[model samples]
Target: MLIKRVFNNNVALTEDLDHTEMVVMGKGLAFQKRPGDEIDTEKIEKTFITPSEGFANKLSELLDEIPYEIMVLAKDIIEMATSELNTELNDSLYLSLADHIHFALTRLKDGIPIKNALMWEVQKFYKDEYQVARKVLELIEARTGQRLPEDESASIALHLFNARQDCSRMEETVKMTAIVGDISDIVKYHYSINFDVESMNYSRFITHLRYFAYRMLRGELNDDQNDMLYEQVKMQYPEAFECSRKVQAYLEREYQMQMTKDELAYFMIHIQRVTSREKS
Candidate 1:
């Protein structure tokens, strides 16, 4: 591949056989190199071939400033998150996450730590994404030997959440987080138990809440009142059903969103799983 532009000693813009521009990274891949020079393919560590030229330019600019190791680390995190979440992520995640991490490190190094106000919501709502964010911070510490605070995890989770949605905005992500946190709080208070947040039951509950919040945000109402499982759950787990009723009321009041019987039935099962004496 011929170098189209050299971002740094470690990264450069190159074109493929199809004449498509790609950002390629390696250790000293561009050292003593100029445009049109052949890239050392053996030293190539990663390549980004974006569909949009503007995005490619932005990515090229980001690669020019951020260190190659950090970029690679962010890419790995995005790949892992995509697999774990089973979602198709936008390529813009490369730019957004890398830029965020780069600036976060700079601020932390300067003794300026920003607190994430949405930390509680993110932990309660986007549990899997938050876990991935924590792993990202660990990777950053491992690679650069700088430890960031817990608040960074929430910010990273937002970026991951945004990447998964086709029309996601930061405000919408915040709303979803808030909704999940509120419903979880209602369930906890109604049950009067401290949940094992690390348990599989908690993970499953948060996953359901996330999707439910998504549906609510999109205003996609499904009133399936004839669900066969509703009566059984209402009869078997009276307490859980009562808690679900509170959750339903909260949604109705706060977001002007009504819960369908089918949704309430699913909520009962999740609440039961998490609030059971065995799990608690």
Candidate 2:
């Protein structure tokens, strides 16, 4: 395949089956490469589109900057999943998720499905994208006629960790807080922990989601909130109260947890906010 563009020392762009630009991640494909560089087809493992049509020139101008190939592929994966699912993902997330995907694909390929500390919350909160994730599993299965590895499902779910329909960063962070906060609440309620969300720990807890959401923005992944988040979820939130009951039941039954009250509230709030902002 022709090296359409070189993103970095380890990543290059080439033509995909759809005759569109896509990035391929592997070794030696990008070293000492120019725009018209020729790459061996065998070295091209996975190829997918890029947010930048001008990656070559853009990358060159950046000089000291080089993008992580795996992350670039992850961004491409998100684009693929969203397009396949007929869901529109925010473009900003492209840069962020791409980076996260690079780290995740390693763990995923090695058979660890959930790598981040907040993975359980990610699975619970990003339910809609789970449909997109499930499609990734199916896509892999169709290619091999064998079930895709479970970690691939986690890779896709991690896509949800960075998934967003809103391009607004502020709205994105707030809504993510709602989404993850609700997930944390559900888990806490299920375990019947002596929760107290009113304490500052609630703020600390939400901050973790905010930071994870921030990492998505920075195109880096730094997950510290593990099964050891020394925090609590309050039982007193009005919307949180409703989601509390519903998710509690859902968790006990081994079924998918629906969006909790806080999630829906923030979701609708941000949806309206983003739409109105876009319209205005």
The best candidate in terms of TM-score? 1
Candidate 1: residue pairs that collide: none
All-Cα superposition RMSD per candidate? 10.9, 13.8
Q: Write the per-residue lDDT of candidate 1 for residues 37-99, one digit (tens) a residue.
A: 999999998887765778767876787688878888888877888887788788888888999
Q: Candidate 1, residue 64: CA error in Å?
A: 4.6
lDDT, candidate 1, residue 43?
Answer: 93
Provide the overall lDDT of each model, using Cα atoms, as 2-decimal numbers: 0.83, 0.52
Give the range of the ten consecutive residues with the poorest summed lDDT in model 1: 219-228
Model 1 spans > 4 angstroms off: 165-213, 217-280
Clashes (candidate 1):
0
